[model samples]
Target chain A: MRFQLALAACLLTGAAHAATDIDLFFPVSVQGKLANEMARLVEVFNKDHPDIHVTPVYSGSYDDTNLKTHAAIQAGKPPAVVIMSANFVREYVISDEIVQLDPLIEKDGMTEAAFMDQFWPALRLNATEDGHAYGVPFHNSTPLLYYSVDAFKDAGLDPDHAPVTWQEWIDAATKLTKHEGSTTTRWGLMMPGTYDYCGWITSGLAMSNGGEFYNTGYGGEVYYTQPSTIGAVRFLDNMVHKAKAMPEGVTDTNAVTTAFFQGRAGMMILSTGSLSFVRDNMKTPYRTAFLPRSLVNAAPIGGASLILPKGNSPERQAAAWVLIKWLTSPEIAGGWSRFTGYFAPRIAAYDLPEMKTFITAHPDAKVALDQLVYARGWFSTYNVVGVRKALEDGVQAVLSGRATPEAAMAKAQQEADALMRPYVEQTALKVPE
Target chain B: MVALTGTTERPVIRTRVRGRVRPWLTAYALLLPSALFLFGFTYWPVVQVIRCSLTVRGFRGAAHWGLQNYARLFNDRHFATAVVNNLIYAAGTIIPSLVLALLFAVALKETTRLTSVLRTLVALPMLIPLVAAASLFAFIFLPNAGLLDHYLAKIGIAETNWLGDPSLALGSIIAITVWKNCGYYMLFFLAGLAGIPQDLLDAAKIDGAGPVQRFFRITLPLLGPTLAFVLVIATLNALTQVDHIIVLTQGGPSDATAMILFYIYQQAHQNFDVGMASAATVVSVGFLFALSIVSLRSLERGIHYET
Candidate 1:
């Protein structure tokens, strides 16, 4: 009789403890190896939390992951959570594909203000859309100018003094560049110019050149035809075509890193996300500095953010929020920051003893952290991809000697304005009755 | 005419009823599984897509209803470009792949010893996974690190950016596709060649015909049916080719090589514009229908008879 009661109790508990199963889709934007790490972390999370079971779906890069997540949602198989590109958060909010996290914060007995205060202020602009938190800051990054100390010394420039202004940048590039007859032995600079990266780095350049790249408060405008953008385009044109300090056309991230590693390039502008890669790969001494200024010292903050998609069950949503809060906690965020070159979005992460030790061990990381003071939100608008492409195409043409800076920016502005017209018509251009 | 005798007519009617019932039951039994599969996977989703296209919302669920998606697609520059690119790709990939496959088959048929090894090598590309092929081709055509560019530079020629340049990007994609698909099509021609009677070729040769003349007179006429079959399949393959573009280009360098399918994928997946994507799919089906009509008409003309 006692054995029967015990068996009945066991059955009841077994039925109750099946756990709410949820899936999280993430992209390995920095390294392919991170996909395996993310999966392992999910396994640990599931093991620790008996009431929840999480599956990590290995999505592609930032862009492809966005594509797959949207496709899956359309196919009615929405993952409970996703690590999406930070710049894309605005578009998701505009489309109402992502759920607003303010209510979730309220449910946790905290105001949106208190919840957002946990993260670095610089990251909040991209994570929040129209005064509502649509995303939680995950891994964040800023563009850092990586320069070869040996090359700088060889060029008779001080290794300690990095280029501070646009003119100084150009002069340094010219001086560092080497030529054997018509063949270039070492290029002065290199950077990636693929779809997503192209738009990102260009925004950094425009921001540094004292341009508003796109409106920060609004999602319907960009100042592509402005003089600041033209200046930025001209700088690129001069580097590739005139000064011959860079490649004649766009080079991807891998090629840029390879060139830097092989000592084929004297300087390169790359994401702080590549900090770990460059540290692991470079044989020579290197230093990271803030992106050189044309009129001001500025750079764009870029990376992925954790977002909750709409249309999830209440239990799944609650489970996802728990996961998000844990993942963004100081301990986990800091560990991820050290693992990947991306700086932790949580401000408190840096206060930990381990993080302090990490910063002391890798001085290059300190430089990236310091540069964040001047960092601004990345370019995002209603038609994020279209607007960015307009500018990127213009920049590529300038790099290829196919179009002048002024001409390129003019065309780019026209195209960008055309792309943003739909949003603008609904908001800024609506006649007030 | 049949009912001069009422009794005989009754027997005939009974036989007809039995005949009809047996075949109808058999046909239904044969079609049941396939019809279920189509209903579950294809037809049901096609119906769903039609419903979704009329709705204005993100990809996930219907938030509202209108013809806004189709209207937006018509106005979208990228969508228009995608349509143009698909047409160009269909023309570029289908014709070259078919012609090259025919040439390869003809070349191998005249050779006897050790030709199997050559044929096997020709078939290797088809055996390769699409992702692997795309990745391999990406490496082979990489701007500076790729073998093609390396060789071009080594010979004092300017290295071409295969998947980067806006003008040449589509052509590079076409070339890679042709290399990947021509081999598979070659197998079809080889089988068709194997079915041809040896006597026909001998008779052509005996009737004062040389190698070229025999090939034109005897082989060409007989291969017409096979050509039509291969052409239809090749056109469909070209119309829906996505993997290579996904791997190598991701439809970039200012959207130069953006095909309709890839564009639809982007709209549905990346932009979360499923309604627009579904409408575009329906439009693509219409285009395919028109293409099938043209090819079918041509196929009818290509069919020949002999005594």
Candidate 2:
């Protein structure tokens, strides 16, 4: 027992003087290559900062990252930092699991407003909770339309002059679609229908059709069964089940991208985060356009944010702050953007020489950046994934010929309401009569 | 009489103390670390989960304990669908894997040429890590670029979307799982077959019993304990399997393959609803426990070491 006590003291003394160890948990929201790039960036950081040591942990995809972080917290092993989905920050703020960065900014001799102004105005909404900064904007994206030049030529349409409105989009798709005998040889348009991508693209369509996907001001409401959403689903149904211009059922992201590359799909709607991959993999000439709109050229904001979990030692908190600032600095952020094809949320990153050179070299990247002006807040509700899946399931049913758009939307609304009922009862439903 | 009684009592007392110190006390001391481990790792989290299951909260709001989450689960049609999918998956995986493994073991025992090489290759699927296996299957099961499709097309049959179609998605996962584990389970059956005495089999053969009859009357009845053990293990593996589902089906073509654990993951991780997710974990573990106790014990008693 005496020897055990002496050995414990020695170990404690050794642990006390060790370098500050921190973990940066990030996810590859778009592709696997970005995860490797994130690790490389951390390797550079650890080399530069001798006083601090950081481990770049690949925490699966965005959804998996959130789960790992929560389970770790519950199990009393919280990570120092996490690159959470931008929309999820709102829920974290509500849960009080995330620390407010306002005080930290003030300690650094900067006002909260001035610090928030460093990012694009659209990004601030998701990063701030009730006018206080909570998350640092990281990699960001918006939906973009990608069209194949070969398919356009085959259809006798100009690739450079991409469609800008709903009417033109439908017309171009009709023309681009080709039928050989009874089977369609080429699809006119394709988009991903997996859970995360499905909800994201659908929200983009809803926003462009002049409908608010959810009340950006609140976290408990969505207009799933509204005219705007019905119209969007109906349009997709018409394109696929009715016109046979698009594949029925769910087309995954890889499938859509593959079809586009193979000239089997004339056009596709996918994340701007995929810009780098598309540019690299695509052999033929291609062009990108803003998502076609009925009332407005709107796309939902997509990306992740760097946030500190609430429970951390003071030394670790300081270390995490240092890591976050260094990671989001103009040099690192711009480099990451060039690597991943996601636009750096930091506005000043574009002014840097490397970003400028990279943009000049890749014109498709410029189109992605230019479309940021029309980007809106992504759908974030009290029960975000559940609410999103409610609508996503409905839309999938419509594609599969299992349910009508009207019936699907109605079911979606009811399911979303039920998922949100706990929150609703606690707040909105607790009205003083 | 008194001197004889005293001598006998002295020996009995010494033996009792030795037994107490050697087996009983040492067994408890050895079990201490494991008990503490369970207390910290398993039982505590299970308690936390049970507590959280009875609570209601929004993403960032205060939680109040109630029966809301379970009630919500009951009313959720998706949850019902997930439960049904899990049951079907368990049924699909257990029966085929056990039967195939038994068949492989018997065939391997009878074969004479390159038996060691065959045995080595049979367990190859078990050696590959699950992620690699899943990724390989994902590519192999793809509609166009997949090996399965390529072979089918070559054979003049239309390609099947193994992981894409809702009806076929669960079946595809079960097939992958069986392929991955059947060979591993074959090892257990092979060991069991090796343990059976040749004298018993010779006697049965001498009585004019054919291969099938000898297997039923002599081999199967004697292999009861091994069958029970394999059945329990296979059922547990099938019940808890989620990795392949994550990589391949992702609970879709409309929740056709959403296992209970996968649904819990969606709730906790994707939705960030910890309370609901915790509740789900409790339910899944409870279901697994109930299944283990009832089926496993019954099979062991009714089938194994039969008179």
Candidate 3:
């Protein structure tokens, strides 16, 4: 009778603890190596929690990931979790396609506000909407000025004292630029002018010029024609057309990085997420600094966040929550941060001994973390991609010497306003009267 | 006697009609599976796209039928730019590539081992996937450190921002398209050249016609149908292929290289504007259909099946 009882208890335990399988759609925006790291991390997670099996789906870029997530939701087979571009979270919320994390936080015996306090204050605006958390901050990044130490010294500028103001920044670029007759052998600076990166770096410039590139609280308005934005465009125009310190027209991220690695470019403004890639590939000594200020120092936060998509079963969601919590925990987050070059979003991740040692050894990452004080929310609004493209088009026009800054900004504002018309009509423009 | 003969004839006619209807029924029964798939996959999606294009989808409310999406598309400057750019792309890629394919086919018409090796060499670019080729050329076109620039520097040419400049970016993309597609079309031309009878060429030669004259008067006319078919295929390819665009440029540098399909993809995937994307799709399909009809009609006049 005792043997039979033991057998029955073992069967009951096995039945109760069947594994719950869930998919986590993740995008590899920075590099392909991070995709492998993500898979390894998922394997570790699966090994640690045998009852909750998480499969990491390698989604494409941020835009492609957004597309896949929406396509999955439409097909009524939504993934349990997605590491979405943080700005796209609002659109997901607006479409009622994502689950709010407030209740999940509350169920964990903590209030939403208390749970959110674990992340940096700069990340809150993009992570939350209407005081409710929809996204958990994952790895995050801010733009940093990555310059070659050798180039700085060769240009007769102090490598230790990096440019801190717009004037000094232009002067340094001019000094660093190398010319062979009418041909430019090396450009002074290069920034990615691709779709998403273009808008990001441009917004950083606008914000540093004391402008809110777009309204953070609302999703229907942008300040494209504002003075600060005009000034930012003019600054880029000066660098490209007048000073000839930068290349005319648009250069992609890979091209920019290739130029920098080949010593064809002296300086570049790139995301902190590229730190690992640069450190791994670059043979020469390099250093990082804050983005130069015009009216003030400013940079926009970038990178993805973990969120629960809608249309999952309660059991599956519970499993996903377990995965999310485990992934965002200090050790895992810090490990991922170190591997991917993004700063850990969880504040406690920085306190880990390994993390502390890593930061001490890599001062470039320290500069990225230091820039967080000036970090602002990325430009996210209704029809975010379209609205952002309007500004990108304008900046590109100016960069290629096709239009003046004022004209470009005016056109951008008009186009952006047109894109947001539907949302604006429903909310801001809908008067009670 | 007349009534009995009429009754017999009527029965025979009925039997003949029944025999004809049975075979048609059997044939249609055999065709039903393919017809069902054709409707389900092709016709149904097209009908749905037209329906979606005529409706307005909002985040909160029910989608209502309207023409606003079409209106928005017409007013969009980017769409206009894409249309103009696609035209230039089609013209730039189609003519040069077709000419190159013809030249290659004529040069290597023989089936000797050396000719086969040369043919393989000429057709090599067709083997690489468009995405891989685009990536390879993206590096090749890089400003200062690219393969092209490095070689050109020896000839006293300065560095050029091939993919960055608005004016040059489309041309660079066209160059890649020409390189990739010329080889594929050359294969089709080789088959067409093989079909042309050597006896006719020998006869032309006996009449003291030179190679160029024989090519123009005999081989060219014989290859007319093949050219027409290849032209249609090439035109369709020029309009449809956007993989390279996505890999190299996502329609940037002030929308200089934005093609129609890329614009539609951006709207549907990136922006999530279903109505606008559907409208754009409908317009594109209409354009493609019209172009196919016009090309087929005009090219039919020049086609000859026999020597």
Candidate 4:
């Protein structure tokens, strides 16, 4: 009788503390250690919220995470939450595969605008659609021009003043380039020419050249063939073919980082997310600056955002919301920002004592944050990956000396239009005749 | 007496017929599990993919049954480039690797201690996973600071972009594939060489045939069956193994190394165009099926086997 009573008590306590189990799908776009950090964060959340159990899944790169999330939804096992690329949130919203966060926020007795005001304004554009919130800005980044101070000094260029315009940028690169016989010992400039990175940097250049790159309000159009965009492409073409300051053909993120670290690349344009990695690995002194401008100082935002995928139970979603809130809270957000090189999306994160101290120490990170004044939304569309690849292909062609900038941009524009034709027909072109 | 005999014979014949039917039923019952598995896992998915290829999705309106996906494939320059690239990749990887394997098998057939150590050294690359090998090679192929360029520079050679250059990218990948697979194929060739009767070689030696002559006259002909099997396997691998591509190039420097499977993957996963992906899948599988059938048939007829 005593044994049975003890068993009943144990069962009662177990039933009382039953937790809602949910999975958080995250992608490791930077170093692999970030995945471990993510798991540790989830562990802390689970400890604090005894009623929720969050399992962190290390999904692959941004593209792979998108694919996995879609596959899971189709397979009837959608993850409760996902940290997706900021640009891809638009596609998910269009396909109705993600839950809008407005209702969830309103349930907490707050207006959507008040809640969204917590994040940077530039991030707000990508996180919401048609006046409804779909994603919560977790971490955000803008492109920064990273240059080796040692190389600058070696080239006899002023290390105190980085290039502020495209012409100066080219001149600095040409001066920084080193040659031994027929071989180039050090390249002037290098940027990641692989798929997602290529499109992002290309769009940044276009925006800096006074072009919108793509229609911000619509999902079916791009300005690839516009004069501003063509000018951007021509600039990159001249870097490769005319000035011969950059390497010809495609280079991936790893190669670019490797070259930068080894001082084989005097300067490079890379995302701010790589700041921490660079700080840890680069032995030489380096500095960061805003991307060189053609007509305007502009940089495209690139990073991931926290989202709740559709097709989850109410209880699971509630549990996920708790996790997201905990993650985006100022203390945790600031900690994550310091751990990663990404500037925290929440404006309050910067006001924290720890974040302020970190910024004071890492002036390069401050340059990234300062560039936010010129930050713009990433290029998002109905089929973002396909559309982006269309432009990437053209840019790669021009870099490889295969086609002229004009011809490449025209071809890219045609391909992007064809890819978005179905969406165009359903939305913009479906007007009353 | 004759009527009694006929009745007895009729009962025996009936028993015989029943006995035959029972064994046939047992045979089918034994095959049921594997047959079900093949249909469920293999044949069913193929049928579904073919059906999916015929239906258009994510178009201007709701999906409908049509062949528009196939029509789209014809106009896709990327798909065309992938097909041509795959052909070149197959040709580039298979022939050189096969010749190398054959040479290694002949050179190392004696099984001495030195040969054993040499064989292990040759087979070392096969032991590493393709993804890991590709990553290692990525470092080795780095333009200026990489091992290859560093060594080549000492010899007065200029730096070359191994993976970044479109003209050189596919060739570099093929070289890795060849290095990875030569030893694996060599093992099969060794097995085939062992199966060849030593007396035939001894007889050729007594007849004044040189080593090369004996190899051509006896060894090459005898190794035909093994060659055919290995060829089929290499072809399948050429179509299926894309982990290296994913790691190294991702079909770029202008889609220079894009293979059929990678193209299908991009269409399905990246673009979410299921119809286009399914159509590409059907074409690739169909090509594989037809090539296998034709090669196996021709090889079976042309080759001779000793009992």
Candidate 5:
């Protein structure tokens, strides 16, 4: 009788713990080796959860990851989960390609309010579409202004006082730039002007300059040719052509970071997500400040979110849910936050003991967290990439001296409106006659 | 093997047609695999692209004169710029590459102990993928502090944005494409040189011709077919070799380096306007087809054989 009871218990345990494997397509937008760290975390999760196993695939940049996920879904091989750019969540929801996490939250015997209470309130705008949770904010960042202390001192300026306004920024850059017979030994300021980074930084500039950049609440509109945006573009043009403090044309992220490390650029604008990378790589003393404002203080929220794509098998979905919960739990979230420079998306993660210790150890991380008060939703639209590239192309032309600010801004507006027109017509224009 | 025409005394029915079909069957069986794949992946996709090019996107069957997508491009300055840039890109890369390739092949024509190694060294760039070559060139030609700029500054030349400046961006891309294609094209020139009878050069020498005169008189005329072939290939390459622009410029600085193929890609992949992309693709294919026909007719006339 004792032997039979032991056998029955063993059978029950075996049946309960059958493993289900799921794929997680993730992209590392920042410099740190987050892909390897993600793999290590997934390994730990797989060991802890015998019923669910996860394999993390490192998709390239944010845009590349979006493309891969869309292709995979169309090919009928959607991954169980994807770490997608937060701004792309609405488009995916509109396309009906992602699963609503609200149902999953309710299935776990929890209220939507109770589940969403775990994360910061500001994240809800990008994480949900049509009043339903479609994405879980994984990590988030806001743009920060990084200035070299040594360079500032060399320019006879106080290192403690960073630029507070666009005029101050241009003045500080001009002062910092060392010119010897029409040669610049060091640039006053530099920012990445390449594709995704270009658009993000440009939008931040537009927003800080008292422009909405686009309709944040709706996907069908943008305010590109408005006075505020035109002014922002003019400011950028002045920085390159008139001030001669910043480099002309597009500077990629690698170039920006490299220039910063070499002391070739005195001040640079970069994501707070790169805080850890800069902290690790920079041998010079540097400090972070808020983005200089022309009219109002604003910085767009930027970062990725974990989402469940549709077409996943029920078994795979269950496993993915288990994996997502484990990855976003307070302990993991806090740990990832410390590992990377991004502030933890979950509010409860910051309350963890380790997180408190981390914030104390690195006060620079706190700056990004405090900037959260001014953070706004990223631009998401009907056709996110197409609409975004229209502006990016025009801004690149302006930076490269190919078009005037007025022409480029107006052209960008026209192109963007055209790209959004089809969707706009389908919904906004289609009405009962 | 069955003999169909042989007299069958037992009155067995003989199908001579089956015997006749055996050879054709073997030939078709050999061709079936490639034919199926060609139809599936290549020919079918071409049909689809052609059909899509004629499609009207916004409203069903609402194209303007069956040319809405094509008509829309006429007013686009970017598209117009891309067409002009592509033509310049073709001429710019082709002339320099062919001239440099001929020079390299002539200089390294002999199979001496040193020339053979030099020949291999000259051809090394072809081994690298175009995308990788583009990446390598990006760092070399980077704007402020690139490898090329660093060296130029060392020589007291003012810093120039090689790939960033509006005027220089296209030239910069042209230079990289030349570097990439010269080696590949040189191999063909080398082959053409090898096929030339050495006796013709000897005869030219006997006729009191200098090296330049002999080259122009004998080697040049003999290499006409090869030049025609290489020109066609080079033209196709000019349209398609957009990897460098993609990695380096992305048709930027106001569409300076935006060749037609890259423009089509931008419209389709980046802009997500498949209708415009398809129309642009059809335009490109039509251009290539006409060019190819002219090239082939010239190739037929240019062929020469040394008796």
Candidate 6:
């Protein structure tokens, strides 16, 4: 009996040792159902890959995920993988807290260039640095114009033809807006003016107005006071204060979406990532279109990417690679894309039959993916969130009628410049003539 | 095991010596768990923060020397805005919260059947978490269709963007803080009132004092220490209870609701500027510490424990 018990214990220990235990940290920045879906996806991955046991840890928002991941890393208990905000990858690269996936790709019998080519071209800028992949693009988005078909039809505008230019968009919004005496019954437009989202939509507008919010290639400069940016802010201000087409002051995403669903808003500019949410919750008939532009079509790329945080043992790193590959495989990527509103970053994911069927049924998803042609890099600089908030704060003030576009943008520029000065002084200004 | 002979006592004596040493050893051994925890988690992080405040992220070594982070913060306009907003927030939340709490406490002091229900209803806000309370208020603050706007419209008031407008956002946040905190603070005042001698108020009434006069002369005078303690707590809360601000405005419509701790959190997590965050923390704690000390010293000096 003792010999039999020992043999059983030996077999149990051997089986336990065979499986690699790994933790994957993720954040629910999108919506509640997506968080549930993420947990489900992990369960499926674990079930299929019996050799590896992956535990999905729900970290908080994008910022919270970064904090928890960094803390865990510094405490010498780094997670095997993290789904970090794409914009934050730069800071992680600077801090040397993220590992490059080049060697991992090579080990998989793929070149780094070929591996990255699987993703949309726009995502490459944020995912790869110094010709090495530090992050794998999982989900990505660009801002798009969403308009209510009922509101459009009631306003004497063609529901089939969406606004394709800023002038037409303003005119459409003006007609769509309704008022009874002095009180507004329906706002013509609504956009989230909170942090992160505020900066994102503003950058998209700035880019469409033929300007860059920050240097696309550099991490130490912003052009907040430039004509394009000021013009963009003025457009937003006019919508609220001048045209009275939009609500005055800062509206968060939840409020914006609620208004859109209630028919309190005629049109809205929201992230493509919100597509799935709007589709599921919106009771009114709505249509998605390219963001109406002033000069050129543009959208700021938004979303998170799967990353391998540094300080993993070779065995753990290898296991993490396998997990990342499985998650980013076109089958899973396409499924996630359909489940969430965010478009699949992997180009081939769209070619899948299910993705095609889903896009056919939901024309909104097609508009989101089609807009990828106009999508550009998001604004990422030294002290990204702070610098982004500087502009956001100014925009919020403008929305509240506290400051004019010129003054707000100028103030925003000064604050952003001051925040980036240390980095600039260290790099750009360090050279001797 | 008891030794009766002197010869047996020597080995037993050594055992006694060992037992005596063991108590001292065991006392330290018992202390080790809590002492190590305090040192590692609390004292150590504080020391590290203080040390880090003196330096910035560097390449070669410990980096920049003294006061640079402080100097940088002094010049930043947002830092100035944060300080001014913090002060305004403290005043906005503290004064209204205390006065309302005192009013509620006075009304519900002798909790009977109706007063008990009223008190429970009033204290209901205390049960909700700060984030939930903030979220509840956020829905109420919504424009046009919101509860506040809907009710205000009935009174001939036009739609108001409670959280969206820069001018009104801080006031809205303050209202949420007051609504949540007043009920919690009211219980403390109720306890204070319960401890007060009712006979003193009766004597004042017998001496021809009016209700207001009796309240001022007997009731208010006896509640001085409680008032001082609650004031400190309320003030500290006003400075630190920022979860509502996070959920509602995110310190915006142009940094209107930004507090010192919120600003520090933004620095540490959002900006990833640990040195700046640590410096802000030290200064914030220093300012709060000084304000608390001054407040207690000035407010409690004249009070005497009567109950």
Regions of model 1 farther than 4 Å from truth = A1-18, A71-77, A106-109, A153-157, A179-183, B1-19, B43-80, B110-113, B274-276, B305-307
Compute the DockQ of candidate 6: 0.61
- The C-alpha local distance difference test score for the whole of candidate 2 amounts to 0.84
RMSD of 1: 4.9
**i-RMS, every candidate?**
4.0, 3.0, 1.3, 1.5, 2.7, 1.9
Point to the candidate with the largest TM-score.
Answer: 4
Q: What's model 3's overall lDDT?
A: 0.91
Tens digits of per-residue lDDT, candidate 5, B1-307, equal 3553464443434445555777899999999999999999999999988888777777322453267778887777778899999999999999999999999999999899899899888899999998999889877876557898788887777667777667888998999889888999999999999999998799889989999899888899899888989999999999988888877777876567789998898787665577788889988889899999988897868666555
Candidate 1 CAPRI classification by DockQ: acceptable
What candidate 3 gets wrong by more than 4 Å, as runs, is: A1-17, B1-18
User: Per-model C-alpha lDDT, please?
Assistant: 0.84, 0.84, 0.91, 0.92, 0.86, 0.88
CAPRI-style docking class of model 5 based on DockQ: acceptable
TM-score of chain A of 3: 0.96
List the candidate 4 regions with Cα displacement exceeding 4 Å.
A1-17, B1-17
Per-residue CA lDDT of candidate 6, range B1-307, in tens?
2342444556778878766886898899999999999999999998998998988664323576688888877776767888998888888888998999999999898869999999998899999999999889888988887889889988878878889888888888888888999999999999999999878888888889998897787888888999999999998897778899888888887888787888888888887788888998888888889999999998888787763
Model 2 misplacement above 4 A? A1-21, A43-53, A72-78, A106-110, A178-185, A313-319, B1-27, B38-69, B114-116, B155-160, B197-208, B271-287, B296-307
Minimum summed lDDT over a 10-residue window in model 4 chain B is located at: B1-10
- What is the C-alpha DockQ of each candidate? 0.27, 0.31, 0.59, 0.60, 0.38, 0.61
lDDT of 4 by residue, B123-198 (tens): 8899999999999999999887789999999999998888988889999999999999999999999999999999
In terms of lDDT, which candidate is strongest?
Answer: 4
lDDT of 5 at B70: 81
The order by descending DockQ is 6, 4, 3, 5, 2, 1
Cα lDDT over the full model 4: 0.92
What C-alpha RMSD separates each model from the true structure?
Answer: 4.9, 5.1, 4.9, 3.7, 4.4, 3.4
* Model 6 lDDT per residue over A1-433, tens place: 9999999999997887688989999987876488889889999998898888889999999888988998899999999999999998987886788998999899889999999999999999889877889999988889899999999999999999999998998899899899987888888999999888999999999999999778767788999988999999999998888789999888888788888899989999998888988988989789999999999998889999999999899888988999999989999999998988899999999888998899999999999999998888877787898899999999998998889999998898888887787778777778988
Q: For residue B78, what is the lDDT in candidate 6?
A: 69
What's the C-alpha lDDT at position A51 in model 2? 76
